[model samples]
Target: MFNEAVTQGDDPGAAAAAHAHGILPSADFCEVVLEEPKADSHGDLSTNMAMQMAKTQRMAPRKIAEALIAHLDDKTGMIAQTEIAGPGFINFFIKPAAWHPVLTAIHDQDGDYGRCDLGKGMRIQIEFVSSNPTGPLHVGHGRGAAVGDSTANILKFCGYDVQKEYYINDSGRQIQTLGLSVYLRGRELIGKTVDFPETCYQGAYIRDLAAELLARDGQELFEKDEAAAIMPCARYAAEKITRGMRADLVDFGVTFDCWFSEQSLYDAGKVAADIRYFREKGLIYENDNALWFKTSDFGDEKDRVVVRQNGQTTYFASDITYHKDKFERGFQKVIDVWGADHHGYIPRMRAAVEACGYRREQFDVLLVQLVNLLRAGQPVAMSTRAGEFVTLADVVKEVGRDAARFIFLTRHYDSPLDFDLELAKQKTNDNPVYYVQYVHARIASIYRKAEANGMDLGGFSTDDLTALSTPEDVALIKALARYPEAVALAGAAMEPHRITYYLMTLAAAFHTYYNRHRVLCEDDLRLTRARLHLITAVQKVIRNGLALLGVSAPDAM
Candidate 1:
């Protein structure tokens, strides 16, 4: 819970200066950071502030550490003892009584224990899973959705005004191809032989859409010209597929605050207006009968084509306009969750944001790598073009939403993941979600047992924690104390996987403590009451963490 002890009331730098007046620099020279020791034998918290100031003081680190310790003030009696470890590191062993505040804070705060004010209500927009509406969302898009949604949740918990968005790519060549795919399938159903090009979508859903169109409007659709028929087919298919996508995402525990359409940019003439604004500022120029953006001026490798010589705008042009609109809407930060294949697009997009008069730091992109779904360690092949890929909905139906989301976030977004179908569906310790959820359920079972024994679950106070003096009790308390730090760090790094890692670690700690300690001691009613309160805090923290990841923490397995 205490990241920097020196900065909190106890100023080690000032103490050192007071000990050796004018010999060392002021406390502002370097930040004194205290870290929790990995091994309990080392100490509760350790710092290397003495070594950090050794060069300026011209003194050995251990000697400086000893001097600082001798002059340090412990008015609150939080620290039980201090030791100089290897290479002049000062380790402080916190008093057992000091940890009682953490348990009390956990109980007092409950669901809001880990929430922090890191963002201070900054407006942030996270756009993710903006997949083309030509097909169903595959597992890869599912990963993006999990990452983006969890990141937004983490940021929101950190006091940011977060907005989740889904950018619809409803207007493009992909839409045209979707329309053609459905139109060709419609002609075939009407006994007219039509050649389906490879460029068109080949999914069975296209055929379904074709059949639905015929049933809705009859064979009269075949009377329209091919050019005129494509738009109607495209519009219908896009609308249907987009609706299905929304349903899939909602079922997967993801709901967007906004659904932005790419076609709206063109409809409002924003793209042309943005290009004109850039041209006026000399950022856009006509070269070889094409308009080029000078992205190279803003750290891009070279200029990019915004408009082709054929007088048609490229996707880049629309992207520029979309980002411009985002900034104009007054979001302090914009985060785009994209597939790994779009990794190279970051530079140009950052350049565009900078050209729009915003700092590059304001724009962030999370590139989610591919997920290779497996069944009992064997790879399941997938190809969207061939229409052979497994849909996200299928996976959710096979292994529930909680399992799917927990597995998706087990790895960092930049790393590839192998989601085993059999493993995810298992109820044993091998499944990460089950392992974590079991902690919550196990604690709930303890409460039920307490109720059966007529043990009072209420009237918990700091005095009840007096029985919590064992090493295992301290370790669990320490783990519970780190939840706020974990949430704040995950938000600061924009990595939701960090929360998953923290959850696993905390769950393991709880399991270890539960196995070794008897929470319900018939001989000692005080100890039983104390242990119940401790585990209750653990359950609350676990439930809070799972909520951030969009996963459920069940009271029963």
Candidate 2:
């Protein structure tokens, strides 16, 4: 919304450039991008139009910037000053009145202020944390859960028809391993001596499931051969673990529109059909008594086996069918979130998508790197095969849902995260969640104080809005104003960490302003009302952003 001010009122930059050069409007400029300067000394807003025209115009950027500023006069009345900065960057200092409109927008839009129509009505499906239903979700899955759920929320806020989904990997070798694990544990329940294998799951849930199966199925499960009983055990263990995963995700503030079953793909013969289509398209070949996808042709390291010599399909085959099913469901775009270890799968996945008659752009993969759970300063131990990782439920229980989510997303998806458990639980500035939430709580405390002091909370005068002209005040407002742009950028790039970064910046500015200035002064009524309205807007924006990240903006600590 703040960025809209640059183009809506009048041709702010383009008209100025056209008038200066006597060329067509926006003709000489490739693209006029406006952003706040990192340093306050560089003016309020800076654009690179001069550098854009330098190569084509055959002139120094400094000369072009000087020419652009010469034509910018009081025609807009918005720019207070204009100058050419280093390397011919045109920077504009807008009058304080220019930021007043942002307050009106924030007040009027409320919860809807930062929402945009960037995605229009396009349908998008996001699949994340589709971990095989073998054990509880660990902290790695926690990062994916936060990132995926927040990304879906951001896209929906930006007006996309977004569908959040979790694919159940219930039909594979892993599920069979879960069955063997349960089967072995079930015999132990019957007072029979059984040896556990390194390949089988070692989680406590396996013993729990064994107890349940022993009570439900009785000795009947043991009466049948392991081959005949493996299917039932696999089916039962998958359902139990999947239900636990669903419950845990719900508790973590994540929900899915669909709990897609991988077994359903096989039961419906879609996997076979997809293989036939690949065969017909000449995308598959036979080698060493196995069916292989021509993935090497698509820049993969080597050809991949879709069907082994034993006639069982690989996980990649099922994934292709799953994606094909996603596109056939009328989704225009499909996004899958997987761990960074799966980065090598991107090329073949794109190739499969192209073979399914969709462009490469229609499908995307977001690779989430590992999260190193840290207690104090040391690494927390985790053993996936032993089912000994600190579960998402454990993290949520320890730090609260809001703190867990906020800390999980404090870093970008591709970057490795060192999740400091102690810091996440800290109620101090060292904790980002605490810092940002305190800004909101402080604003609420001001409102309570305002009512007690009989201060006007109904409306504020825009004339007094300029009374908040201190550098910290302006910085706080600017941070809040850039929310819409942050949402758009994060959604378009699938980065939820941007929201966390913005919230921290806004919180720091608000904290600085609160410490330095007074919100409800005894002597200055107009200034009091002006700053009250300002902080109220900040509270609204922080809530809006926190809502997207699935975190709470508390009225009090």
Candidate 3:
């Protein structure tokens, strides 16, 4: 794309580049902006510094651009040409050979090529998929799992001290309900006619737990009293369901660094301590026999009750104290990925964090929208059976872990996604995961086929990269070079789905190039080596992209 143009300081990219040219625009030109052009024909990179310097220099914008271009060198053989275009925009065209070193960088870095020191190793804790330990993880939880897990992987890739955590709601009324659900089910199995309350959990898993409870403890559980037995039953059911949740996450390729227990906060009296600290700050007040947190003054919609008249602490109160504990553990940043339904809750949580003396930006809640699972372009009814909803385990079992993870990341976390289970199951190009993974498999096939024919590529070397002159070859190489930029952008924006789309583009370019030309050149050894080296870089980048999404890059379909 270079017509042969001759081409940092903390001060903006345009100013730094201008300083390199020795023709400083006006002293007043303090700010500068640089961006990659939308169209390659415009140039590889563009800057509008001329417009920025116009009023200060009192010169025509185009004249300033021309003067700047006149002093600019060919960026040490990287920039082949520079031109002044629309409204004094300076565009620089980079030579093909300059891009060649990106391939070399990929070769040297390999797995670590797309990584950067963006986070600079700051401690970040991401708590997600903390579904109550009352039922199996349903499809709704699956979306948050994918978003959170992939996000953690990305932050880690970007050089952050990242920890993935799952919070277990092992306290409060829910745990009691789980125990009651299991207890009533146990009575039914023991031939005791008991009316199950409508408020109890209706999942079939609870019945299974109840049957196990009855088999183990028998009438002795009821011999003393239901009150005496309910506590143990609650603990048992919570443990069982939590175990199943962990298993499901493991199956889905998600493993948390910690399983935080809500009960632990209460056990250690952390909530009471946090409340007392707030009271000392004169932020907590007793009203109508309940302890109240004046969150309204801190930007919340209204004041919230931290403790009820009966002395039971609210979930909000415990969560506030839990966040305080998170910061005390030395996490520089705390990110909680919650459901979109909690959008209104963000204000209250932020207010609480601020009232606790932490900056508002220190705590962030990533609200993940709902996912609608579809089959053959129609909605799959996700109603319950035996009190259990259609679970995430069912979806993962049908389409596979890789497909489930990849498809779930095809859109941003905030956007609604209609997951087509049928499309995800397909082996065709319509299935994006299969399409991208196939590129890796195809490259592997090229090497295997070449080696089988006694046309070994030997070791990859780029001494004869000049053989790569075709448009398809150049496009594929260019696409390969964009992997790091894509990764940086995606990680910086916290949009992991962007990486999936980037891989698809790379795969398509590689596929197009492969169909047009051949890699194994029997007559030309240099051409063969060059193509092999290029395709090897392509394979590495594809693998890198796939790895970021927590999906596998298979060598064979």
Off by over 4 Å in 1: 1-30
Worst 10-residue lDDT window for candidate 2 reads 1-10
- Flag regions of model 3 displaced more than 4 Å: 1-34, 222-224, 384-388
Backbone collisions counted per model: 0, 0, 11
Question: Could you tell me every candidate's TM-score relative to the true structure?
Answer: 0.94, 0.92, 0.92
lDDT of candidate 3 vs native? Answer: 0.85
For candidate 1, write residues 231-344 as lDDT tens digits.
999999999999999999999999999999999999999999999999999999998999999999999999999999999899999999999899899999999999999989
Candidate 2 lDDT over residue span 154-244, tens digit each: 9999999999999998888988888888888888888888889998998888999989999987977955678988879888988888888
Residue 349, candidate 3: alpha-carbon lDDT: 90
Model 2 CA deviation exceeding 4 Å by range: 1-33, 48-66
lDDT of 2 at 44: 95
TM-score of 2: 0.92
| Cα lDDT computed for each candidate against the true fold | 0.90, 0.86, 0.85
Candidate 3, which ten residues in sequence have the lowest lDDT sum? Answer: 1-10
